[model samples]
Target: MAPPFAGGEEDEEARWCGLSTDMMEMILKHLPIADHISVSIACKSWRLATSDIILPALRAPWLLGSPMASTSLSWGFYTSSNGGQSLGLEIPTEFQRQWCCGSSKGWLMHLREPRNHSQYYEAHLLNPITGATVELPPFPPTVIKGVISTSPFATDFMLAALCFESTNFDKYVIVYQPRHPRRKKILIDNAMDIMFHHGRLYILTDLAELLVGVFDPRWKVSFKSIPTLFEEEGRHPDTYWGKLVESNDGVFVVYCTITTGAERQQLKVFKIKEWGRHHRIVEVKSLGDRTFFVGPFSDGVSISKMKSSSKLNIIKPDHIYYITGSEYSLWAHCMQKRHTFRVEEFKMTGNILEWFIPKLEDRSNLMVVTPTHSTSLLLTIIIVMLAVIGQCLLGWLSI
Candidate 1:
């Protein structure tokens, strides 16, 4: 195809360079961080536009390639940015073989059974980019799901997992901090799904009952119960799926219940609101600008905060991509089009296919600025300048 605008090469160049700074910045917002960084070096105006904009959390997650793919044994090496395409990844060979159970805040749960304890599995918090591994505490082998508060690269972050305790199948949620010697345990018999939102852990119980767990600075937690969303069906579990999804508005508890009939499975979504003593959940009519994806395990992601150029364009908004009925039985609930259909291409039957997202920014460029380092560095620079000035004065006086 030929170019749409017809002009001399010089004239076309001038037209692009003439765009105002605000307009240039607006255009750059639709591009990925790396792509915009590349555009910055093109000219002065483009550089000025991109310099001040804060780098955001790229929302579209990378779908781990099918375990059966032929690429590098495809264990964890290959990735599909969009559902249809494949890309080669340089993940470490050790990580390539581990079972990827869950992902949160751009970190994957890499678990391996070395000694094979009936209760726990040996695991490492993997940094795929550098292949740097942090030895993590023993994690439950039978985990329902887990999440990390922030990048483990930071000094303080928490890993929370909900799993059965032992052979009797007692439900327990364990919280692990990096430097802490012991893990904190919360025994909630009927808890369905858990989410860490706004510094508080929200535990979803039977029939959409909300339990908010408030954590202290020391990691001690206290629970506050919120009112139920709807009338109770019975003591039996009504929530087939309950996940805390981030929307454009805020973090919301999205719970789904399946219809009792056998012909086709129907799913309902509900959003929670806070009231004086009793928080409330309203049935969600549509997903506003959020694509919620849930796999067979306990991981669900709201893919909303993304750039257009980011390969995550494969995930569409107002849609829910989930595996129900069976592992291979994948369905997409498209609310905008009011349509639901089976997604056949994504069907993976044999090996586990968990959604993996590592932070895109190079770690060396990232910094955590606290009073501890910044203040000391400032003092050191001042001291060096003062010493140089003193030495110069002495030399001049001696001369």
Candidate 2:
């Protein structure tokens, strides 16, 4: 046999070739998900061994983190998959000047303003994973004309790039400064007052007018206004004030306080959903002011009677932590239960609540206050049973 096959080296090579693809795949599977990527480049054999594993595992990070962190005004990003390190992309130095954002789907949107002599404003969509960037076309001439004459108006431009409409994978840009001369229909002047809720962008332009716009990567890029019921209400416009609250189900509701002189004010809640056509408004009487005193506040122009509006800090879709001040004391409302805490009850001067979105795994940190409606009666039964069982002598004796 040795004489016939050169010490049987041919047999060894054949045995290596005879190894099953299944065995190779099994070895590749044992490697860490990240190292599996490197294993694919080991050789043609290993690359084939790893091809099917990349996609399913690569998309894991995309499906887990908080979508708001990627597209919100805070511009916060967190990833647990990459050793818990946030992706450090090179943000342009002009990012603050122009506006920049990252989407939940791992894409970035950058907006650039026109220079002294140029008439064009630039926007780009970038995929950091592949390092591919696509330049969005300039705003239409009419839109551009509208932005330039209104220098500060261009600065009021707000942008949202949504890769998928049904999902929360979107990016938002808010510009708070005036646009350059001859710039297009983009405005960021009121960008600071703008916030993204659900799939739409809402800008609190008025104590009255609420500007609602949809961000479409495939269109001319203009804000199609939605109807705000309070937009038409009367009296010293300064007397009527409002604030926005975003529900978890992607619905936005405005809590408006209309002061009737300095003593009386009415609190009204209006829900804004959809946009044109299907947009519906519903008034919620479930919430109201804690009889907080209406004040004489000034709106720059004149001293007008204004009410200290009930400030709602959204804890989640169904939970709102509202803070209101009365002539006697301060109050906090969570799940319709009102608790009054005096000005010095503990130690705090400003608003007591801070709103935040939790990561998928970190949700246990949140206090989920369930509504006490008929729907929660079933849950109440379960809780009461468990509590009784824990205290009953017979229950513990049987266990």
Q: What TM-score should be assigned to candidate 1?
A: 0.67
**What tens digits encode model 1's per-residue C-alpha lDDT throughout 181-290?**
88998998777777676667777775567788878877789888776665544344443666666544545665555666322444556676766655666777777777
Name the weakest run of 10 consecutive residues (lDDT summed) in model 1: 365-374
TM-score per model over all chains: 0.67, 0.33
Clashes of each: 0, 16
- Per-residue lDDT over 147-242 for candidate 2, one digit per residue giving the tens place of the 0 to 100 score: 100111123443332221124422223221222333223344323134444435555444345676664544334565656565455443444445
What is the Cα-based TM-score of model 2?
Answer: 0.33
Off by over 4 Å in 1: 1-59, 65-74, 77-81, 115-119, 130-132, 232-239, 259-263, 275-278, 297-299, 305-314, 325-329, 336-339, 345-351, 362-399
> Which lDDT value does model 2 have at 334?
27
RMSD (Cα, Å) of candidate 1?
Answer: 14.6
